[model samples]
Target: MTTTSTYDVHTVRAAFPILQRTVHGGKPLVYLDHAATAQKPQAVLDAIGHYYRTTNSNVHRGAHALSAEATAAFEDARAVIAGYVGAARNEEIVFTSGTTDGLNLLAATVLTSAQPGDEILLTEMEHHANIVPWQMVAQQRGLAIRVVPVRDDGTISVDDVASLLTERTKVFACAHVSNVLGTINPIAEWSALCQANGTRCIVDGAQAIQHCSVDVQALGCDAYVFSAHKLFGPTGFGVLWARYDFLDALPPYRGGGAMIDRVTFSGTTFNAIPMRFEAGTPHIEGAIGTAAAIRWLQEIDTTERIAHEDDLLRHTTAAMTAMDGLTILGTASHKVGIISFVVDGIHASDIGTLLDNMGIAIRAGHHCTQPLHQRFGIDASARASFALTSTREEADMFVEGLAKAIRMLR
Candidate 1:
């Protein structure tokens, strides 16, 4: 991958109005926290606002013109999203609240397929969403949850995954990119291993979607999951994409209005595929905003933009690494634009507080991956994540502020 790109960061930054605001005492806001959630772009906000202003109506089963317009926009969003993820069919995309909800739905589906002694293999670097859902499922069903070890560099090796695979391994759950480490995982190879052993491969793409090019079919996983907000869209939206066979076989997660085809006192028939999984009145504006975001993404050169992000990350990493007493947590060779670190003799919360005063935004604490932090022998780390809208100046400011914060704490 090229270190430099012609991708215009300033132009992209202008699209996000949040970049214009000053956070603390009139200092320019340097948002280095995209991993937690991204700031919405004007195009996305406009699309959502336009929908509410012009086409605010319940979708499907409506004779009104507004409902017809809303339904078209909504279903079109599904097709747009499905195409973005390289799904074979739009019906494969089932909307959820976010990646957490998607995991819970997958957890529920996999539960029905697993027996008491069956095993679910999870990587040690997984976020709590991927971990807790399976933990709950294992407790409910008579199944076991096995952990795949993460290396010192915040990556799970192929050998580690291979050693964990067994006949009873029903589901091999993994992340496309480490949310904490930012390491790009070898999902295709891992999925191939799962397929060889008759295990279901489910990949969490919550972190990967915005950073790299992702093709669900190319990854060769049985299922893929991600949230829209991470992709520069609205909150309260996520997507779960599974094979047609799995969607047909997996039971509904909830019983509700849109998900049921027929309901009788004795029995009930559920809706088909995507609708079956999407039980209630879905988030109409969320879908519209997500589709808008995808369209905006398509309009730009994504490959170039990703290269630009990498450039910013490499620069930031070098600058942060050179600082005295500041140790970056995840040093994996392959990663997105994430820098998680802890300053010696300084609590992470204190660093965060100091950075906030300087108009710098960085995340502190376990970052929702407590196990990963425990593995590193620390309770928390300060994280500064980057997105396409992020600029080199912001990275410089963050480093300068962090150094000052460390001196203050000492």
Candidate 2:
């Protein structure tokens, strides 16, 4: 459990069984798509299996023993996530499907507080999950939506954000890390600025949480959202960490049995902070799995893990940048463990396919950030995202496969 041995990358890789598996005629699977979805460790998988096999029951409804046990496990998961994100209280953590679901929930509930002509501010570097929801809300309520521009290097300009902020700007939603560019935005600074401007800040921490430590209280954001799957947990479960007062004031996002205090022909009253947002049958097993995963991550030394990945990034970036006709996107000084690039005269899909055949799995396309891609005048790019389990050999394999693909295309 203790990784005291000078950041052993191979030791970490050994924990994930799927990493050794082969595809494409016995070729080793070199997974480089951790940003899209991380492969689960055996600990996470076993935790999930353990939940369904042993502690399977509905939570927070019945007074039965099974329900009590299930509720304890579910709430324990909430506490663990709260601790991970540095939430002030467990009541501030609301469970959702994932980052997209968390964002949509915010859009739905928070927009109810907005009046017509109020602006919702977003950045150009947002993924579609962040962009589309705000667009829908803007369209529905006739609220003006503004965008804070990103610099050529892919970092959001604080100056542009300051200029864009007006009294009418009710909410400012930004990504903590750019999925395509790997740019780490100044969330803490932006959060402070939004606070001064009387704007609520909602941060998408799906990528950032995995790369670095996230403390929601320290970041000073009104709400921070991330997915469990991205943090080596089960899919279909995520966390929405909101300020306690904000969570109390905001209306319920979904309507169902557990979220209501009373149901009558006249109307229904909603429950308190966390429970108010979580409706119907919750993903009890997923929540337990998430807690287990968080515990597993907490067992390792994060500082060393981050340092190891940083080294991998530097190595990969150097190798890729040296290649002829390769253009790396998002050269921000501050970045996550992701590299996105396009080879000249090669379609991203082609690059991805060729790499896949060589047992190097990567993501291709605009990576759900068409606006950001349009800014760079490219259709799409090949992305290689690393995790704690990634190795130097895997990074080298990606660069080697990409070089071969470029030659094949030419």
Candidate 3:
């Protein structure tokens, strides 16, 4: 067991004012919806505000001083984000609206290279954002989409994936951690398997980036995608890190002012690897906020933060296990700070509503992974996810709230 210092949690929570706010008729807010989107700290908020106030100008077009300053700040944010993800160069990092946009870009670009018989491999536990785009591309390109089945425990089997791969497999897209099941996939081993089988691996890191350390190069993945909102940053911003050679080979997803080299009436040459993908003006302030969010996380000892969340998870798990009619989902040995479960004789939405009345925010429904819910023979689940600022008291309150809701419903 990792021993955590109490002061770290206290100090970290203090930086997030939303965690201290009261809601729902003056009740204290117990936010357990970090998986969907994390609340930004003061630092991130200030960074966004500062950028808009002081350096509010369009990038890469104007020759004015403000344009230069804004361009520098935006590129600086890109560099910071690249460093945080352990990418070798900032040119390899492409900013998108969110993870969905990043995945869509990859699907669209890679589809151009795929032929009628080419196969794109995916896992059963993928989010709709990761699944739907590829399906659309496959339909248009006459490509085959193969799904790797998950075990009864909700974790994907590498052997099943190995069996599905062949010489025709062109792309292997999967999630690092399932948003619904909280199962952390074996990404490194899976990437190696894909490499051995001549498949390009794309990892959806939306759920994994907030809880664990992510190093794109170290993971040996062809591409990695994650959203900033899930990591205590602003929405409308995400990252896609790809190998330079692969990114260079792929055609541009979009073409516009910033992504062009020479625009003639007959033809137009595209820009470099990242700029080729970034077609228009991006979310400038969002990028600044994301950089600030990463800096804030870097300041904290990640080991301690992980340990704190694990303690809360353990306590919550024990309480859920003690309940007579409750069945917890996703029993992967390695998971992050998320718990999804169903109470007997009650719908997940009812539990979510009851908890909301008590100023506790949780998520209920398929969680953007309807196929996963169907696989488990469940319509939905109530999820309570934690973060660095979550505490044991909040976990206890969640359990109590659930108990109250169960009894009332019964």
Candidate 4:
């Protein structure tokens, strides 16, 4: 179970109880869908359960000691995440339901300052979370949505995005890493270009945060968005870290109890930056768990972890590509430990089903990048995304399962 010169992966695997058992019959679960959602580790689970059992209370509202404790822990979690992403201030980090909610909140809030002729630039490799919210708002505001094209190798150039920018371009948003293609977008380069053009830059870090280090100030994006669950935390929790300048002026996305300051029959005032955007009772335990996930990540030698993942990527790519008629999609040189492939004359869903029967979980279909799939002339592709605990054996199992599936299908 030891990978590379990296630390013991078996030790890491021991932290995840679910990795212990087999799924159907005696088949070990080769969970390769980390890009979709990561399995929570024991630290995350313990943090959440401990919170609900020991300090359950309504944060920022209640008067008692339990409430104060919960509030402090929740805000502390925000600070941890803010530091993790290198945000300028803790107030810049706003908690949302997930990546979908974070992107929607940001898009809605920023639209409050939009004019009729504004343009929002997005890349073709963006997840639907980054595309749909902008599309909905653009439709309503008469704004235009322009896409930065992806290359045949599943990578994008900053020059391509810059070519599309103009005086009318108010915002440029892109995913830091593509979920399907695993292309690592040059966010800092594009952010610098957008800033020079007087445009706001946003980065969707859902896929990037888990794979590599992300410093928002270093990335120089006006805003950044990511989900905690994809990084080994609880679902229903995400972070949207915006620049300090945008935090004060962006309008609130929802109206509810905690987000408001004063209410009147005629008009109501709102709370400060983050609280204004985070409405209703927040997920207190979810926040705590997310902090634990980040803490666990920090505990590991990240260099070693990344090296292990890179080894997995290289191994999987070689094994899968060695099979005849099996084509690996998105052969970007800078991709992370995710492999998307298609077997000729075989359906992706069938491959997924057969793998599932073998206790192997992978993502199938377009992976929410239908436009990318369309560009590649494929309706779907089978994706096996690696995580911290992924090993050479699991990679071999995945390739062997797919080979068996392809033989049967053909």
Local distance difference test values of all predictions, in order = 0.91, 0.90, 0.91, 0.89
Q: What TM-score would candidate 3 get against the native?
A: 0.98
Clashes of 2: 0
What local lDDT does model 1 show for residue 220?
Answer: 96
Give candidate 1 misplaced runs (Cα > 4 Å).
1-4
Candidate 1 weakest ten by summed lDDT = 1-10
Q: Per-residue lDDT of 91-138 in model 3, one digit per residue for the tens?
A: 999999999999999999976867898999999999999999999999
Candidate 4 RMSD to the real structure: 1.3
List model 2 lDDT by residue over 60-152, tens digit each: 878898889999999998998999999999999999999999999999888886889999999999999999999999999999989988788
- Candidate 4: regions farther than 4 A off: 1-4
Worst 10 residues of 3 by lDDT: 1-10
Which lDDT tens digits does candidate 1 get at residues 185-206? Answer: 9999999999999999999999
Q: What is the TM-score of each candidate against the true structure?
A: 0.98, 0.98, 0.98, 0.98
Best lDDT goes to which candidate? 1
What C-alpha RMSD separates each model from the true structure?
1.3, 1.9, 1.2, 1.3
lDDT of 4 by residue, 172-255 (tens): 988999998887877889988999999889888999988988899889999898999988999988999998878788887899
Error of 4 at 313 (Å): 0.3
Question: Judged by lDDT against the true structure, how good is candidate 2?
Answer: 0.90
